[model samples]
Target: MSFFAGIKAKWNAKMDKVLKIGDFDKQLTEIIADGVVTNNELETIKRLIQEYGLTEKDLNIVGVKAFRAAFKAMMSDNIITQQEESDLLAIKDILCVQNELVTKEMAVLLEHQELRNIQNGILPVIETGGILLQRDEQVHFLLDCSLREERVVRRSYQGGSQGVSVRVAKGVSFRVGQHKGRMVSERDVVVVDTGNLAVTNKRIMFLGSQKSFDVIYKQLIGYQVYSNGLDVHTSTGKTRQIIFDNKQFKADVLQLILDRVTIQ
Candidate 1:
């Protein structure tokens, strides 16, 4: 190929990529125009992300914009209803937004839902994950946060020294040695795993990378709310701390649980 032809071809490709970005943004804006995304629209979003002209980074940029726009549209009224919340979640998942990336805004949305629920004596009903829900069980958001569990670890320390052995008799010898260190219990706060933390009308469920469990509202004996997380105690004498990036989210979850526990 001629040098000029090669240069022109490369330029055309670059221009096409830029054009694809504009097209992707326009499509996304339209999809989220009504503040909701339909199941059929998912394919369109996915196709745009996978467009051959754009790079992975470019797709993500477009997707993030759409994701944020969806959030704003749905919550424009300062409230995200059950269906709108589902739609928002769908957009997030399709856009591949990690839980940590969404901590702040999602926390705010949950707070909105919780406050609204209080006014009407309603619990935010949501689709449950993995664990089978019992009768009357309704789940809220599946939070992406750190789960902390207490565990016992043994550490050894030197307590004594060894002495030289000497021959005391023809057939016997005397030897001296130092004693071993004593074992002591030490408590530490560590992150066991990270994953979705869902609160329900009856329980607090966590599905994590290395750990998963549930604490029922009835079994929830007490909880201490912190700026970044929560320490919950269950009737079974188990204590777990769930950590979030935002203080407001911690308060929101605590408040929602407090309200739910009263009537459960």
Candidate 2:
């Protein structure tokens, strides 16, 4: 038993030395998370990664796991107390932001590269030499803005049995009022303030009537620019033609966005 215990202890000591996190590892990750590290530290890490051919994706995944392990060790070793758990959780949230940003950048890069490849390889073949191709192929343009489904609460002029009469703005607004309030003139009812509103975005596709429009939408989606529905403004006037398949309540904007974009 004593001989076996000695062998196990020796193995553990050897493994710990090889797998320990060093100053370079923590410093590099801190800089990656925040830019506080000196420019030289940033360059050093960048150079080492470049020399070793390591990618951002590789670092993020590895860093997440390493930090999680470190956090666990800190927890177990009394390095961090119970009150510090919230602080660690907040750090984890910051790490999540980094993860999301890295993912978004990768997606944007891949999508743009794909678009370039398609324009180089497929577009010319279709435009110049493909069969049944015409000089004026009725160039159809599609504009895909980020259109998300939203709920617009409408207040009725008359109160019901419950005495609930208020409008809930779907988009961020400037007006804040209670459900039970005296009726004010239309002019007095201002748009809700952007600060105190319950506006949220959902991931969805928007379609306009053109190809260039579609490309724009793709770029906006990659960049996270989105809207609740179609906001079409022309030289003469502005019109919103939100397409929906609902047979009833076609006049309502909220219903239209929900019908066209969201699953009922």
Best by the TM-score measure:
1
Clash-forming residue pairs, model 1:
none
Q: Estimate, for each residue in 180-204, the C-alpha lDDT of model 1 and write its tens digit.
A: 6666677677788998777776777
Residue 52, model 2, lDDT: 45
Q: Output the lDDT of residue 83, model 2.
A: 32
Q: Counting only residues 3 or more apart in sequence or on different chains, how many pairs clash (N, Cα, C under 3 Å) in candidate 1? A: 0
Instruction: Kindly give the stretch of ten consecutive residues in candidate 1 with the minimal lDDT sum.
Output: 245-254
Model 2 agreement with the true structure over 31-103: per-residue lDDT tens digits: 4443123446435655655554444544554556544553544445433433334333444443332645345
**Which portions of model 2 show Cα errors greater than 4 Å?**
1-10, 13-15, 22-24, 36-43, 46-62, 65-105, 108-226, 236-240, 243-264
Candidate 1 ranges beyond 4 A from true positions:
1-116, 128-131, 152-154, 164-177, 184-187, 246-250
**Model 2: lDDT of residue 206:** 31
